[model samples]
Target: MFKCFYPDQYLDSTYQINFEQLYAKGFRGILFDIDNTLVPHGAPADERAKALFARLKELGFGYCFVSNNKKDRVEPFCEETGGCCVYKAGKPSPKGYQKAMELLGTERKNTLFIGDQLFTDIYGAKKAGLFCILVKPIHPKEEIQIVLKRYLEKIVLFFYQKQKKEGNS
Candidate 1:
């Protein structure tokens, strides 16, 4: 069961993930979270964020942005990234993942979903049967809701780590 969350399926900071490495991993497509993952919550896209969008395009990867936020909240970034956006996506419900795939017109076997939260991003990806990559939030000050969730995430991660170690042994 622990094998469901493979170590290689995660990325530390979004910036640290090599686009080439993701392609090598059999991921021909990517679905990304807009707020807090690409930019600080409520902030516009930074230079690095814009570069990442361009980089994905250059790499020939099919990508989309699936955000739990409303249209007003996600429109700018979606425009900046030039990726299809699913507003009010209600992630952890698999709606966003399904919509993303529909927009990309691809299969889950060649796709990856990237985000900064376990409850939403990770869980949604798992439920959709796609590879999930968790990245650290772009800024700690961005979302109060995420800050609250992190407290619970620590406990869950602790148990997951222990379980993984025991299973490997």
Candidate 2:
């Protein structure tokens, strides 16, 4: 029942993801969520994010930022990173994900989505038939709405972990 919220993979952070390995695994495009995924919510693009984008390009990966935030929040970051972006993305809805794939010029099977939220990022990407990766949030502090969502996310994650353990066993 909570399958829609399950991430295909979970990693410690976006920095920890092996882009080269994903490239080898046939994922040609990557769609990233900005707030808390690439940086803390409302934070600017950091050196690490810039370096990661450089590495992704070096590895022949196509990438774009897909964010639910308004243009004011997303534009400067994209400009700093030189990445295409879809702002106010309305995630968990397939429209933004499809638009991201179109921007990357990749088919669904070849696209991957990475974000810190399951309900928004993973669910939306999976719904769009793209592989999903969930990363730990960059900071524990969040807006009240996100804080509330995190409480519910913990319950979903509990079941997700149980299922993973059972599958392995």
Candidate 3:
């Protein structure tokens, strides 16, 4: 079952994922995890973040933030990004992911869920029948559960990286 619990796809870093690159792959919508995926946990957006969101909008790709965090934690960021936010989402559950798709008015086939956790972000997106993009956490201390998850992640990522390299070869 452990092998059954692995992510569908992986990325070296969230920053390296350009909307244009993904657009070429036929992904038109993006659902982002708030903490770690966009910014460090409990951290606010910097100037670069504002610019990034602007570019995402310019690309005409639908994007939204789906976070398991409370409204207090998610609202401000959504406002800052000018994107919709689904709070108290309970990731790995597909509820938030579904809501995001509704907000974007798109189907799962055109969507990409990007986040730092395999269990929540990746699994939930997979369950929702959307493509998943696994990104490294910006900060380990953002959530207590992340500390343990990160440990497990190290092992999973090793094999993931090897497979990716082999695929390229």
Candidate 4:
């Protein structure tokens, strides 16, 4: 019933994903959410993010940040991380994800997305016909709306876990 919101993969952290394996599997591009996915919400890109981007470049992958934030916030972080971005992305809408795929020059078949939220991030990727990875939020503190969503996410996740245990994934 709620299958549309289920992620292709769910993990504890974005940093734990194996980009090399994805590359080996013929995935050439990645789209990312900026906030709690990579850092605490609103915090600037840190050294770890920069290093991850560096490793991605070393692996010959094309990548970009698909963020809902305005240019003021997304630009400097992309600049610091040596990555590109599509700001004000209006996620869960196909246009922004399409724009990002265009920016990376990747087709949906070869592109992947990693993010921290189900409603915005995972749903956006799924709607765009891209593989999606859902990572747990990096921090406990979040805006009230997100906290509210987390409660609902738990219900979906419970079903997701049950499905996984059944080998449906």
Candidate 5:
């Protein structure tokens, strides 16, 4: 079964998430993956991303980016987006996620993780005992390795949808 890889919630875009509601629910920390999860891969943090982080801050939530991308990419993005980051994060392993939570001074029960990848982001966050939200990739032009993984993701997602439709999720 693909249950372990299944996200706590699957949504169309990270922009569509109701962070206010999440804050009201006592989720004070948010962990994020950069790249397609925010802007397109290799793109810098834009005004939209900056605004969103500002809004999250106003809502009294702390955020940290957990990215597999090297420090060169993650550091500037994190700085521009108004949050901290753990670069070269080995995702699909809970250590990075746990470290991000520590940086934010958050507990597992009050943290959420959002990203575009299932195998890395969702699985790692789940292992770290954080709520995971899987968002559709922002752009389709990904690296060959990710493109290959998307094919497998589709099969797991098919079953995930079926389970959700049957109200078992």
Candidate 6:
């Protein structure tokens, strides 16, 4: 029942992801979550994020930022990082993911989604049939609603881990 929330891969941070390997594996595009996924909540893109985007571009990967935040918050960050973005993206709804794929000019099978939240990110990506990667949130500080979701996520994660251990993944 919780299968849609399970990430294809989990990592400590976006830095740990091997973009080169993903490129070789036939992933041509990526959709990224901004807050907590690329930086601390409400934080701007940093040097590290810039470099990562540059590397992705060099590797011929198309990418876009898909965030639930308003345009004001997402636009400036994407401007700084040189990325296209769709703000106010009501994730877990396929519209946002579809918009992102359109921006990347990629089909679902060739696209991947990376984010920190299982419910909003992983579930949405899975529903859209895109490969999903979950990264640990960059900071602990979050809105009360998200904090509560994190707690619920832990329970789902426990079962996901167990399933993996049993070779059911």
**lDDT of each model, Cα atoms only?**
0.79, 0.91, 0.81, 0.93, 0.94, 0.93
Instruction: Give the TM-score comparing model 2 with the true structure, all chains together.
Output: 0.97
lDDT of 5 by residue, 1-169 (tens): 7899999999999999999899989999999999899899999998889989999999999999999999999999988977789998899999999999889999999999999999999999999988999999999999999999999999999999999999998
Give the TM-score of each candidate.
0.89, 0.97, 0.89, 0.98, 0.99, 0.98
Clashing pairs in 1: none
What's the residue-level lDDT of 141 in candidate 1? 85
* TM-score for candidate 3: 0.89
lDDT of 1 by residue, 1-169 (tens): 4343333355568888888987887778898887777778888878898898888889988888888888987887778768778888898888888988999988889988889887888888888888777777777785677889988777666667677578752
For model 6, residues 21-109, the per-residue Cα lDDT tens digits are 99999999899999999999999999999999999999999999999999999999999988689999999887898998998899998
**Could you give candidate 3's per-residue lDDT for residues 95-139 as a string of tens digits?**
899999999997888988889888788878888888788887777
In angstroms, the error of model 5 at 27 is 0.2
Model 6 sits at a Cα RMSD from the real structure of 0.7
> Candidate 5: deviation at residue 66, Å?
0.2
Regions more than 4 Å wrong, model 4: none
Model 1 clash count equals 0
Runs in model 1 lying further than 4 Å from the true structure: 1-8, 163-169
The residue ranges of model 5 lying beyond 4 angstroms of the native Cα positions read none
C-alpha RMSD in Å of predicted model 4 compared with the true structure = 0.8
Worst 10 residues of 4 by lDDT: 75-84
Which should have the higher TM-score, number 1 or number 5? 5
Worst 10-residue stretch by lDDT in candidate 5? 79-88
Q: Candidate 5 at 163: error in angstroms?
A: 0.4
Off by over 4 Å in 3: 1-5, 165-169
